[model samples]
Target: MSAPEPVVVVGAGPVGLSAALAAHALGLRPLLLEARTRTAERPGSRAVFVHRATLDRLDAVRPGLGTEIAARGLVWDTRRTLWAGRQVHLRTYPADPATAPFTSLPQTVVEDLLRRACDEAGVRTLWGDPVREAVPSSEGVRLRTASGAVHGARHVIAADGARSAVREAVGIGLDGSTSATEFVVVDVADGERPARPERVFHYRHPAAGGRHVLLVPFQGGWRVDVQCRPGDDARHLAATAREWLPAVLPQVPGPEVTWSSVYRFQLRVAARFADATGRVLLTGEAAHLLPPFGARGMNSGVGDAVAAARAVRDDAVEAYARERRTAAERNVRAAGAALDHLLAPRPGLRLLQRSAAVAAPLWPRAGRWLDAAPYGPRIRKVRY
Candidate 1:
């Protein structure tokens, strides 16, 4: 077959936008299509933590973007754990400055930055235009948009997210399983500031049954995430913060809730990174999904965009499929392990929790190893 046409990237989320930016940097005029009229302005905070490796990757595209983000977001240097009726404070592992330390910035802000960067790079971002159909051709891939406009591209990228329309149209099977656990995440306007402002608190109520709550500081107040218990009432699960906050964190005053969302844990991966025709490719949630733990979901997606951009730029579609599919599988397994470790039954995890608590304070270095080990030296380097 002749060389594929220009690359078309579906979805305008962070991953899609980043891929567009990367492709533009590589001298490819990528067309970015977004079904939504505008980028997400969701009130609730989604991802706050930016690992050092991701920072390095961002820096490759723009010199000061990562540093500016670090300045805007809060720095979390400590972690507090509530275990067995006792509050244990531990110094969290510090990120390597040379590699890029972990930083906490809202997902909206990050997307906005990427969108702006894409604009500057001359990428065509067509909002309100969704790819309704994708037909692979010898010349390139032809896409039919919702607006009845037809576009042709040498390659197509599916970054449309977990329920990707492009992936379905390409006939790529999403291979993976979903867990029964449900989680509620809320961004509250609570005026109460954490006493220890520089730390993230994981409150485990001894008497609150098996449910767990994680509280992290955000721009206005705290972002609270609670896990739903098995067979819990939906109504009660939805309105859990008001009822459980007092039991979870007795120190804070109630604040107005700004936004709330519930998500079920799903672990999914595409059967193949590229379609049978080899023109359509999947990235981000379109390729795989993982529960939000250790902030791996977003980071892994960002990594996918970076890798996909490299593949497109080099005209190495097959290599891109091989590398990214492997990476997605690895991230899926890592996220599953993290979820199991965090949400395991109290009795079953008590010993492991105790060990972490003890090791964190005693060796300090052990904490750093755990935090940074997942992102090894190989993954830190910018491939493109």
Candidate 2:
């Protein structure tokens, strides 16, 4: 028998796992190398939204996978913005039964599901085996792991995330700047349920100089994300939490904190999706990163994985680079715009926010446009 078709995937995060799954579905035996020993077990919540387009893609690869995830996750249909004591409910688009609905699930749960799917598909997974170096040649790419074992593959996919070692080794520069705003994410047990279970809760402190806090109900609790302004001490995360929640979420009693993390927002995109050698390709955070404002980061990466896998299967790597690069750039732009609009400091911005709130009910079309436009790209199934 001939040697097995070689494809190596670095990183086993959701994006990495999805890429591996996509490759496996396309009849390629992929070797997935992950630095971490296992999937995350903690309660930290990140990237909770998955779009309808992604669900369709997942369904096509492994039937009922999207439905399985949805059964375990929550469907968030409405978005609201809060200012002082006032709440503005935004308009929502009707769900299309033909396409899957947009759903919110914890990152850990999604990764776990993908891991199980990979196992069932017989994809080779190497844990704690960090790729030390990746060298490309005329024939194929050679990877040396930390344990000194060398492996060769016809193609290498770098899904290792923002601090991608594969991108560094191949010398691809990321283009973008980190934002000034920092966010603190705190997860706590659900002390009480909200009156409205299906809507995302947003609270802006008018007296606190426009500081905003968002309470997203997930699993058995809520994920609290607070925007921190300049000159704020990172150590004051807990104090900020206590001060903000009582005013924002009056219904839920104070919760026992579970996990908290501070992240600085950054928007970046790879200068090139493929390395100079053309044997190595970048996907997920390896290719792009967006501010977490609109949940476009993971959605964009998953789309990249799907497109890249299909391109490789059809021997259209160049087309993969072009398509993914365009998509990444579009997401970066949308994420930046959303962040700017949400975090605006001027009186004009306050006016805009207030206007958006007041007009949402009168002109529901405009409200739906603003609320769904940023995330709309993720739902579009682009042909590679």
Clashing pairs in 1: 4-154, 5-154, 6-154, 52-100, 190-255
List TM-scores for all candidates, in order. Answer: 0.85, 0.87
Candidate that would win on lDDT: 2
lDDT of 1 by residue, 24-108 (tens): 7777778899998884455666777777777777777766766666666666556655544455554655544343356666778
**Collision count for each candidate, in order:** 5, 0
Worst 10 residues of 2 by lDDT: 375-384
Per-candidate local distance difference test: 0.70, 0.73
Candidate closest to the true structure, highest TM-score:
2
User: Clashing residue pairs in candidate 2, if any?
Assistant: none
Task: Look at candidate 1 and tell me the lDDT of residue 194.
Answer: 54
